[model samples]
Target: MSLAQRWREARPPVAGVHLDSGACSRQSLAAIDAAVQHARHEGEVGAYVAAEAAAPALDAGRAAVGALTGLAGSDVVFTTGANHALDLLLTAWPGERTIACLPGEFGPNLAIMAGNGFAVRPLPVDDAGRLDVEGAARSLAADRPALVHLTPLASHRGLVQPLAAMSEVCADLDLPLVVDAAQALGHMDCATAPAAIFGASRKWIAGPRGVGFLAVRPDLAQRLQPRLPPPQWPTALSVLQRLEHGEANIAARLGFSVALGEHLAAGPALVRERLAEVGRMTRTAVADLPGWRVVEPVDEPSAITTLVPTGGADPETVRKRLIADHGIVTTYAGVERAPFEMTSPVLRVTPHVDATDEDVARFVDALAAVSA
Candidate 1:
């Protein structure tokens, strides 16, 4: 079957046009069923026994994360969501509480770092808010913050960060790099190695909500050491496993495992290619709408396209009208999503690989009417 056909068959159905994959994609029916089955099994066999039974699937999920993120499953730690994963890493971070990141870093991440007692500093970036690689390397070498945090793809815009080059720089300088791949994974190539990479299952992966992960390099895992003792006697769990909380939603995790399996079966490379095409289609179609400007370049390799409404039209109002009147879903990106870079709110549309030309056209028609 064609990829689109398979994607359509995998999910049940939606009420209306969904153009906010950047916020959350539609979960496959298999993923939903896996979670339901696990929940039922927990009630039948008791939670602990059911969890023990799910070991293999959980391991495979970690392996899939490793395969996609260029780390080992042994170093992967599952958390509630991307925010939780970042908390685990930041709270456990050693040395001086200072970190460097791009100006357009995810806003909540800045809050997390600040709450963890880290002082925020900006890395060098060009006019478009993309990292200036050579300048960034020099800045890192000179300033030498405790570590570097990077959001390869921000929620407010579609510009892809230069992670591979930054990763090389961090490697050469022996600096620890923390990557927020919540928007990058599943939507684009995310195979670069960093000190740690964390993301959610809900976004591009179309996994269940409340499931996220953190994958640390084995060496970094060893360095972080144990904050709390393991629940079991004799401590047989790996370092990363010890970092995981004792209690978690087994059903959601099982669902995430199923989602990971689906993603792998669909093929990550093809999935990315399809998303790029969807991005182009969405951008080209929406750019033609009157009084709304597409923020990202037409060919930017991201599924997300930020739309800035001209003539002072409120993005929040337009977003609400699109949903309430037109039955089309999209998200509004405010300055709070990327405080340093975004001056005002912009509408964000991110259609997944399953999206069709009709979907784009529906959004275009709805947006033009709402804005008019």
Candidate 2:
């Protein structure tokens, strides 16, 4: 059986047509079971004792994340989630307070920067909301922001920022770059690292919520100073170990490890191809819907597609109707979710590898019916 079919069998049946993987994916059976089992173990063994025994599983989780992101096992440490990870990275950075990012940066991430007193500068973006790599390079060189941040796959839009080129620019200028891969993790061959790629496991990895990872370069990690001191391993001492301290959700980490293993077994490249195909099919299905506009370019990056209504029909309303009436799921993309104002309100439609052509067609038909 195909990986998608297998995954679907392992996961809970979709409540409706689940096209909201961009928001959060349903966890697989193995992940769910692992979590439940760990929780049970903790209940029996006592939390701290169970946690201490979970060392192998935790190490294995780190190794799994390393395999996915092309980092050493020592480079990754589980965090509460992407927001926590981002906050930790930013808090620890003892550099200039100027951070360069696209105007369409994730809302919470932008808030974290501003909250932490960083001068968040905007890097130019094209009409499609993609980063202007040349301008960014120039800005980085001329202004020398404390660091560069990119969300390879942004939350509110379908545009995939040019990471390879941006990374190249950062490399040439010897600048530090951090990637928020919350939406890109399981969809892409995230093998490019040395840049901190932090994300939640629930989004694309199909892992349980409350767990995410921060995989950073050794030098950058070395410079990091976690706000909270290590609650558990006060003496273990490496930057990652220090970061990994404090009581953690052992169950969630084990579940995340299983989710990562599932991805590795299928291979990242194959998963990317399957998801992109489904995305293109979905885009094509809805491209000609009268009065609706597709926001992504012809050549899209990830599996996310955003559609906007030309009429005054609210995207949020349509999203609700899709789920309530037609059993079709989608996400409303509002300006508030972005750092800057969105030109047009949109609905984010993201499908996973398990989605079939029939599923895409069903979603488009549902969309048209609801919009009508």
**Maximum-TM-score candidate:** 1
- 247-326 per-residue lDDT for model 1 (tens digits): 99988888888898999999999998888888899999987777888888899888888999886789999999999998
Clashing pairs in 1: none
Tens digit per residue, CA lDDT, model 2, 1-372: 987888799888888789998888889988899999889988998988888888898888889888877788889999989999988888877767889888888899999998888998899887767788988888889989878898888888777677778888998998888988898888776667747889999988889889999999897877777655643545557777767778788899999988988888888888888887777787888888886888776557578998878866789999999989988888998887784857667889988889988888888888778888
How does residue 43 of candidate 1 score in lDDT? Answer: 95
Name model 2 segments beyond 4 Å from true.
230-236
Candidate 1 has an lDDT of 0.89
- Candidate 1 stretches with Cα past 4 Å from truth are 230-238
Against the hidden reference, what TM-scores do the models get? 0.97, 0.95
